[model samples]
Target: MKTSDRRTARRGAMEQAESGQAAPAMLWRYYAVAIMLVACFIVLVWRVIDLQVINHEFLRSQGDMRTVRVEPIQATRGKILDRNGEPLAVSAPVVTLWANPQEAQENDEGWRKLADLLGMQSDEMVKRLRRHKGKEFIYVQRQLSPETGRLAMDLKLQGLYAKREFKRYYPAGEVAAHIVGITDIDEKGQEGVELAFDQYLRGVNGSKKVLKDRRGYVIKDLSLLQDAQSGADLQLSIDLRLQYMAYRELKAAVEAHNAKSGSLVILDVRTGEVLAMVNQPSFNPNNRDSMNPSGLRNRAVTDLFEPGSTVKPLSIAAALKTGSFTTETRINTSPGFLRLNGQTIRDARDYGTLDLVSIITKSSNVGTSKVALKIGGEAVFETFYQAGFGQSSGIEFPGEAVGVLPNFTKWQPIRLATLSYGYGLSVTALQLAQSYMAIAADGVRRPVSLIRGGQQGVSPQQVMSPGISRHIREMLETVVLKGGTGTRAHVAEYRVAGKTGTTHKVGEHGYADDAYNAVFAGLAPVEKPRLAMAIVMNEPQGSEYYGGEVSAPVFARVVANALRLLNVAPDRAIPMVAGASGSDSKRNGG
Candidate 1:
C-alpha cells in the first residue's frame, strides 16, 4: 500500500474520535464540577450569616465567660483618733491570695512553689486543693504584702489570683490596746472601742467588671458597678498625753508591786469624759499571733470589787443627807467594837469620842457602823443609788459592768453595818470613779463618756445638796493631811482629797484570806476639783499591799504629772490642820 493512502485513513479516524461520545463525556464532567462548587459556596455563605448575625450574642457571651469577670473593690476602713487628733487605729492596704481550683489542679509543681512561698507544706496544700476539687475559687492566704502578691503572680501559675484588702494597725500598740481594742484579719472589730464602734468603722465594699488574661490577672477594667464608700472616722475623748502618762505609771506599778493585774481610770469631772483608761498585762492589737486571752479584759469597767473604806465618805455623806448628822456630829467609839446581829464590827483602835471628820480620817469601822445604824439603811441606799451605783455607766462600753447594790428594803441590820464600810456590795472601778466624780462636780452626777461628743446636752443629776457636798469635800481634805489614811496620796503642791480602801478578794471557796485589792480613789485641788481618778491594784503580792503604800504612790505620781499636763493650777496656799505623824494601824488606812 502507498504511504499517502495510509496517512489519509488515519487522519479520518482521529477526526471521528474527537467529534464523538468522548467529547460529550468530558463536557458533562466539567459541568458537574462547577455545579458542586456553587452548591458548597451557597452552604458556606448561609453558615456565615447564621454565625455572624443570629448566634452572635450567644457566642460572644461564651467567649466573655472565659476572660471577663466581676471583681470586688476594697474599701478603706475608718481611723480611730484620740482627743488631740492622734491616730490610734488605722487601716493598712494588703493583698489576699486566691486560686481557681479548676485551673490550679493541672500544675502540681507550680502549686508546690506557691506553698513554699506561703509557708505551708506542699502536701497540706495538695490536700486542701483536693478537698476543694471542682471549686472555681479558693483562698490560699490572706493579709500579705503587695510585694509578695507580685512575686506570686510572677510565677505564672495558671489560676493564682490576688485581691486588694485592708488590715487593722494600732499606733499606740499595747499602751492603748485595752481602750482602742483590736480587729481580726478581715478588719472586723473584736474588742474594746473597735468592737463598740464597729458599725461606724467598717466600710462598704464595691464591685466592678473587668477583663482578665488566661493567667487570671486583670488586664483591663470594663465598668464600675458600685463605688466604695470609706468608713467614717471616730473621735474619742481619750487624751493621748494623759493616756501615755497613766499607762506608764500604771504599768510600772503593776510590775513593781508584782500585782496580778491593775486598772486606772481618769475622768473629767465637768464633762464626764474619760481622760485616760488603761489596764495592765494588755495585749498588742497589731501583733496578735501570740496574744493571751486573759489579758484582753478592760478591768476598769468590767471587774467588780468592794469599795472598802473608800465608801466611808459616801456613808458620811449619807448620814449628813438624812439631816441626822452634821460635819461636826460626834459618835462614841470608846470600846472600838460593836456587836450587831452576831456580827462584830471593830475599829483599828479605841477612839473614845469622834466627830464626823474624825470617823472618816480614822476610817473607823465601829464609828461608821454606829452612824449607819443610827441613820437606818434607807438613807445610805438612797445616797448610793443616786450616786450612780449599781447602774450602767452611760459610756455603754462593751462588757461594762453594772455593780451590785442591794436595795434598802433588802438590807438587814448587819447588812447595813457592813454596807457602811463598803462590804456586802460590789462596784466597778468606773462606778467608784463616777461616784467620786459626782462629789468632784459638787454632787452632780454626769454620765461617763468615751467619745468626744458623747455626753453633750446630757443633763447632770443633782445627787446631793451643794452645801453637803462642800462639807464632805472639806472633811475629805483632812484625810490627806499628816495623819490621814490617804496622806501618801497628797501631791507635792496640789491639795488632794481621797480615801484608801483595802478589801479581801473573793476566791473559789470564799473571800481569800491573803489576796487583797488595794485601791486609792481621789480628786485633786480640794478647793475646786478638776480630776477624779481611781487606782486599783489587784492582788499585790508585795509586803506593801495597803492602799496608802501600794496604790497611793501611784495616785501621787500620776496626779503630780497629770495635773501639770492638764495645766491645773496648784493650790498649796490652803492650810488648816496639824496632826502628829504616825503609822496607821492594820485596818486604820483600810
Candidate 2:
C-alpha cells in the first residue's frame, strides 16, 4: 500500500469514532446549561416577589428600628410675674447630662472624662456605671451649669447625651418664697401660687421621630409627632416692692419681740388684690436643701388664732347693721367687769359710760359684753358669717385654714359675751384681712385675688348697709387713737383704723395664762382707705406681748412704707401725732 493512502484510511477511522462520542457529549452540555439558566431566572423572580409584596413592610420596619426613634421635645415653663412685671418664679432652659450604660462601657474612659467635667470623682462614676450594668439609660447629672454643659459637649464622650429641660429659678429668693412657692425637677409646681395655678404654668411636651447613631445620639429628624407649645405667662397681683417692705418690717418686729413666728398680709382695699404676703422664718425656694414644714407654710392663710378684740368692729358692724343701736347708743360699763352665767369678763379698768365709738376706742370687754347681750348671739354670729369667717376667702390657696365660728345655737351666755370680744371662735389672718376689706370697700365684700385681674366684680357677696359699714369704720378708728390699744399702729402720713388683739393661746386643755397671740388687723388712711393689712406675732416672749406692742407696730411700719411705694398721695394734711391723748387704756382687754 502507498503511505498517503494508509494515513488517510487511519484518519477516516479516527474521525468516525470522535464524531460518534462528541454528539452525545454536546447534547448533555446543552441540557445542563439550559437547566442552570432556568433555575437562576426562577430564583431571581422569587426574590423580587418576596421583597416587593410579601415582606416589604417587615424589612422597612427592621431598617427603621436600627436608625429612627421618637424623642421628646421639652417645653418651656411659664414665668410668674408680679403686678409690676417683676419676675418671681422663672423657668430657664437647662442642659441635663444622660448616658447609656452599655455604650459607655464600650468606652471605659468616656465616663471618667465625663466625671471630671461633671465635677464628680472618676471612681464614683465607675461604681455608678457598674451598678447600672444592665441599664440602657442613666442620668449623669440633672440641671447642669451652662459652662459645665458646654465643656461636656466639647468632650463628645461616648454614650453621653444632653437634653434641653426647664429649671425654675426665683429671683426674690426667700423674700417672696412663701407666695411664689417652689417647683420640682420636672418643673411641676409644689406650693403657693405655683401649685395653685400649675396647669397654667406647665406646658405640654411634644415629640418627634429622629434617626440616632449607635451611641444613641440623635442625628436626623424624621417627622414631628406633636408641636411644642410654650406655657402661658402668669401675672400675679403681688407687688414685689411692697412685698420687700412688708417682709422687712415683719422680720424686724418678729426678731425684736423674740416671737416664734410672724405673718403679714397687705391687700389693695379697692381691688381686693394681695399686694404683699410675708412670713418670718421663711425658706429660699431657689434651693431647698434644708427646709422646714413650719416655715414653708403661708401662715397668714394657714394658721388660725382667737382674734381677740379684732372682732369687736365686726360686732359693732352687726349692731349698726340690724339697727339694734345707733352711733349714739350707750353701754354702761362703769363696773369694769361683767359677771355672766358663772363667767366673769373684765376690762383693764372701768371705762364708765361709753357710746359705740368710745367702746371700740377703749376695747372695753364689759361694753362689748353688754352690746352682745342686747343684740343676741344670733345677730352677732350672722354678722361674722357674712364677713367670711368660718369659711374660705375664695383665694382657694392650697392648705388655707378656714377658721372656727360656732353657730349661735351652740353658744352659751358666757360664750356670747366672749364672742362679742373675739373669743369662743377662731379666724385666720387672711380671713381677718378680708373682713376689713368689706369695711374698706364701703360694705362691698371683695373677692380676694392672687392673680392679676382676678376680681370679677367689686360688689359684696354678703353685705351690711354702706351706712352701717361706715359707722363701724369710724368706731374702729378710735381703736387707733392714743387711748386705743392699737394707737402705735398710727401711720405718720395716713390715718389708720385698726383693732388690737391679745388672746391667751389656746392650749391643749384651755387658754394658757402666759402665752398669747398678738394680732392687729386694719385699713390705712381711714378715709377712702387704700390698703388693708393683718399682722400676727405668735407667742411673743419679750416683756411686751400685747398686740399694740408687737403686731400693731408691724402693721404701721409696713403700711406706711407700702403706701409710699405705691405713690399714694397723703390724704391728711397733718401727720398722725404719736402718743396723742384720746381714750387709750392702761392695759387693753379682749
Candidate 3:
C-alpha cells in the first residue's frame, strides 16, 4: 500500500466502501430467500386446513368412492308344495358371467378358453367382445353352470366376473305343469299358480352397503341395511299321488282316442278341495323352449261346451225340488220323441212311458225336455246359476273362464227346452263337476279350492234342498249301474254315479259337421260320496266319439286308482274289472 500507498489508501477506502455495498446486496438476497420460504410454509398450512376441516367431507367422499359400494340384494321366491308338503318347485342358485369387454379383447386366449367352457363358439365370443369393447360392463352369459363359472374364474379370463342369481326348478316336470305353473328367466311368475299368487310369492328386494378393498373384495358387512324378505311358501290342495294317477289315465285316453286335447279334474265332495287337475299335451316347465300356447292352456277351467246329458241331473233335481215330480212320478215318453215350439227332442230308444228315475237312467233328451218344461225356464236358470254357472270357480289360477249361461230374461221357448238337456247353454268342466257336487253334498255348493288346509274366509253356499239332492243322487246312481251311457264309468268295488255328454262342437256358423266334445262327470261310492270328478275330450278322432266310450273310461280308471291310492274303503263288494285294479290292490281281494 506504498506509492500504491497514497493511492492505495484511497483505493483501499474505495474497496472497503464497495465491499460494504456488496455485503448489503448479498444480505438482501438472503433475506429475500427467507421471506419466500416463510410464504411457501403459510400456503402449505392453509392447504392442510382446507383439507382437514373446511372441505373434509368432500375429500372424504372421494376416498369412500374407492372403498364402499351399495349392492343389490335379491329376495328368494316362494316354494310351491303339494298337499302332502312335497316340493313341486324350488329355487336353485345360478351364476351370471359378465365381462369388461376392453379387458377381454386384450386377452384372446382367455376369451377363447371362456367360450369353450361356456359351450359357445370362439369366433362369436370374439365378435361380442369387440362389439362391446367401449363398454365397461357387458353380460357374457346368464344362468351358467357352476363348473363353467369356476372354470372361468380359474382361467382368470380378463374382465370376466360372476354374479349370483336364482332359477326355478320343477322336479315333477310336466306331470304337474298346468297346476304348478312356471316362472320366467327373471324369476317372475308367468302362468298357472305362479301367476295367481304372485304378490305373496314374490318377496321384497333390499340393498346393502359394503366396504371393499382395493381388489374389490368385500371387507366389512357394515350391517346398516334392511334385510331382504323371503317369499311366503305356497301349499296347494293337489295330492301328488292323485294328480299323477289322473294325469296318466287322462293322457292314455287322449292318446288312445287320438284326441286334439283333453282335461280332467277331481274334487272332494265334502271339503270342495281340488285333489287333482290334469291337462293333456302339457309341457315341462323346466324345458320352456318348446312350449306352445296350446299346450299351456288349462282346459279344465278355460274350455266350455254343451253339457249334453250331464245336464239331466240338474233338471231332475229342479223338478224334484219344487215338488213338480218325484222318483216314483211317471211321464208318458211315448215315441221317444217330442216336438216343442217347432224343435224336436229325441231319445236313443223309444220308451212309451217312464218314471222320473228311468228318464235320467236312459239319458232320454225327450224325457229331460218334458221334465224341464214342467220346472219352467226361470226355475231351471236359477238352479243352474245357483250351482255356479256363468261365473268363475274362484280358483287362484289366472284365466279361469266363466262359461256362458244365457240370462233368464233372454231365454226363448225353444232355447229353454234346449237348455234342459245342456244345449244352447255352455258350462265349464268345473261347473259341471260342481253341479254334481251339490247333489252329492246334499244340496250344498262349496267353493272349489286349490290351496291346501283350505283357503281362509270361504264358506259353502246352499244351492238346493236336501230332499231333492238325495232323490237326484239316487237317480244318478241308476245311470252308472244298469242304465244308459255312463255304465262304462262304474267302478266295480265302489258305487259310482254319473252322466255322459256327447255334444257336437259348435263353430262360427253353428255346430260342426263331425267334430264332438265328449264329456263325463261323476261321483264315487254313491252311498257315501267322497269324491266328484269330470273328464272332457275335445275332437276325439277315433272309432268312438260318445262320452260313454271316450271320456267315461278315463274317469273310471282315474277314480279307481285314486281311491285305491287313498286307501278309501270300497263301499260295495264286487270284483275289480280287468285293468281297473291299481297296483295296490288284488284282482280278488282277500
Measured by lDDT, the strongest candidate is 1
State model 1's lDDT: 0.87
Instruction: Supply the global lDDT for candidate 3.
Output: 0.81
* Candidate 2 per-residue C-alpha lDDT over 1-590 given as tens digits, one digit per residue, 9 for 90 to 100: 99999999999999999999999999999999999999999999998899878979877898889988989988888899999899998887688998777767644686688888777998999888778879989998999877788888887777778887878999999999989899889888899988988998888889999998876777999999998887899999999999888898889888888999998888888788899999989998877788887789889999988998898988888888777699899989988888888878888887689998888887888888889888898899988998889988888799999999998998888999998898889888889999998888888788789988766755547568878877877878777766667777877688778888888997899888889998899997778888888888999996888888788878878888888888888777334446635334335543
Q: List candidate 2 segments past 4 Å from native.
A: 1-61, 457-459, 573-587
Summarize candidate 3's per-residue lDDT along 247-275 as a digit string, tens digits. Answer: 88889888988999998989988888899
lDDT of 1 by residue, 1-590 (tens): 79999999999998998789588899999999999999999999988888889778887888899999999998888999999999999998888988877777544597888889889998888888878878988999998998888888788777778888888889999989988998888888889899999989988989999999888788999999999889899999999999999999999998999999999999898799999999988988877787999899999999999889899888999998888788888999989888888878887788889999988888888889989999989899988888888899899799999999998898889999999898888988889999999988889999999998658777889988888888778787777777777777777688888888988888899888889989988987777898999999999996788887888889989988988999988887445357744246256636
CA lDDT scores, all candidates in order: 0.87, 0.85, 0.81
Instruction: Please report the TM-score between candidate 1 and the true structure.
Output: 0.90
Candidate 2 — worst ten consecutive residues by lDDT sum?
581-590
Global fold similarity of model 2 (TM-score): 0.90
Candidate 1: Cα lDDT at 354? 94
Instruction: Show model 1 residue runs off by greater than 4 Å.
Output: 1-56, 105-116, 120-134, 573-582
- Taking all chains together, each candidate's TM-score versus the true structure is 0.90, 0.90, 0.91
